[model samples]
Target: MDSPSRRPDRTISAMPQHTPPAPVVNDPATTPSALRRHLARWPTGVAVVTTVVDGRPVGKTINSFHSTSLQPPLVGWCVDHGSSQLDDWLAADGFVVHVLSADQIPLATHFANRSADRFAGIEWTAGLDGMPLLVADVPLRLECRVRHRLPVGDHTYLVGQVVDLTAGPAIPLVLQR
Candidate 1:
């Protein structure tokens, strides 16, 4: 019966140097970039919310997505008030949220760029209420109808009631910074 107290000390010469204490932000910075830097440490999954605007497919890459309810199956994400497709999303009949796979960084980057056409070379199909849905193989896809829209500060939080969804056994893309 060997006990921890009886165990031999295995310390070798100067292995694993002591790490410095993490930097602390005592007084929260006032700049927007400061807030971004503070929040960059928290990892989040990436999602592309798509809808039809002026008969064209519109989409945006966002990390602010979460499941608000299970029985009613409610999901929500936030969109910046300065987004060009704000009005389109607000008036959209429904939208689809695509959970990108771990290897889908290109797709996420394309959607994140506001200057690109977004869907010019992308493969997608029409979804519920004529909303645009990416055809790429992803981790999960949710078809949702607009449930609520609330303006908060510089962003608008959009809530959606998931009417249908599909999930797969795969890793999802996560954003850290």
Candidate 2:
């Protein structure tokens, strides 16, 4: 028989074949389950630290925050040592803390993510210290000037002297394992 329709329209029906490679674990390292267990045991509070750089607002969710000294109105928090945003924060004169209320867990999670526009849909006002203030429901707020910083562990300990503060009637959020 003559070759069927080889002029213009010809069909070659064939199945695409691929090799199935063998599955093997070359390096067995810690898995997500292991990390989850470790992180789960550590409880921390959620605070949104806000500041302005070049007339723009920059904020991040941080749990590693505490009062350093009451006499000088100093407070401290740890930021990842190699964070790209460090330059802006270090250069900025001051920052504000928005102590999330018990019902504002969603706000904490949103700010904590490594995404764009953390201030979107959040009501805030610029404070005298050139920091952003929580205009809505926040249990506490502190505007502080960067006093000192020390490298400790995997983060930079930023100690700030309180320049101004404002507190709301909302309840403070507490995190626990």
Candidate 3:
């Protein structure tokens, strides 16, 4: 697979990184921010969720991808209510979830950005039902058809049945945030 950095992918200017003070666990007052900080200690596998939007490929970087069931081969991920791609994702018939490798940080960052043309010059191909799949040596790729959508709290939970699966890279990409 071609590297996005070597090609003409949208680049997001790096923002300054600062570590906030961790909240006291013993304290009774646990704010939302504190809860977030506490959970950031546990890293998750980074995933890039891709689907077609009006004949063009669109993707979003996510760390919320997880297995739902084994009996029916179900998987799930969440999208924030405020995400611009929420409507497109919710309406998509099928999608591809590319679990990134550690070396695919560039791809993850590209999809996470707010750029309208995330796939500009990025190598990709069509999967099941014309769903877009990134041309990367990822850890795992699941071609899924939408099975359920449950709106809960600030994000909508999307569940799908895995119609196809592939594996490539060895090292999985994990991040605290």
Which number leads on TM-score?
1
Question: Candidate 2: global Cα-lDDT?
Answer: 0.81
Candidate of highest lDDT: 3
- List TM-scores for all candidates, in order: 0.83, 0.73, 0.81
After superposition on all CA atoms, how large is the RMSD of candidate 3?
Answer: 15.4
Please list all clashing residue pairs in model 1, or write none if there are none. Answer: none
Residue 22 lDDT, candidate 1, scale 0-100: 82
Ranking by lDDT: 3, 1, 2
Weakest lDDT window of 10 consecutive positions for candidate 1: 24-33
lDDT of 1 by residue, 77-174 (tens): 98888888888878887789999999999999999997748888899888887888798988999999889999988888889999989898879999
For residues 92-155, what per-residue lDDT tens digits would candidate 2 score against the true structure?
A: 7788888889899898888887776788888888786557887767888888888897888667
Q: After superposition, how far is residue 39 of candidate 3 from its true place, in Å?
A: 1.2
Scanning candidate 3 in windows of ten residues, the lowest lDDT window is 23-32
44-113 per-residue lDDT for model 3 (tens digits): 9999999986887879999999999998999999999999989998888877999999888999999999
TM-score of model 1 vs. true structure: 0.83
List where candidate 3 sits over 4 angstroms from the true fold.
1-30
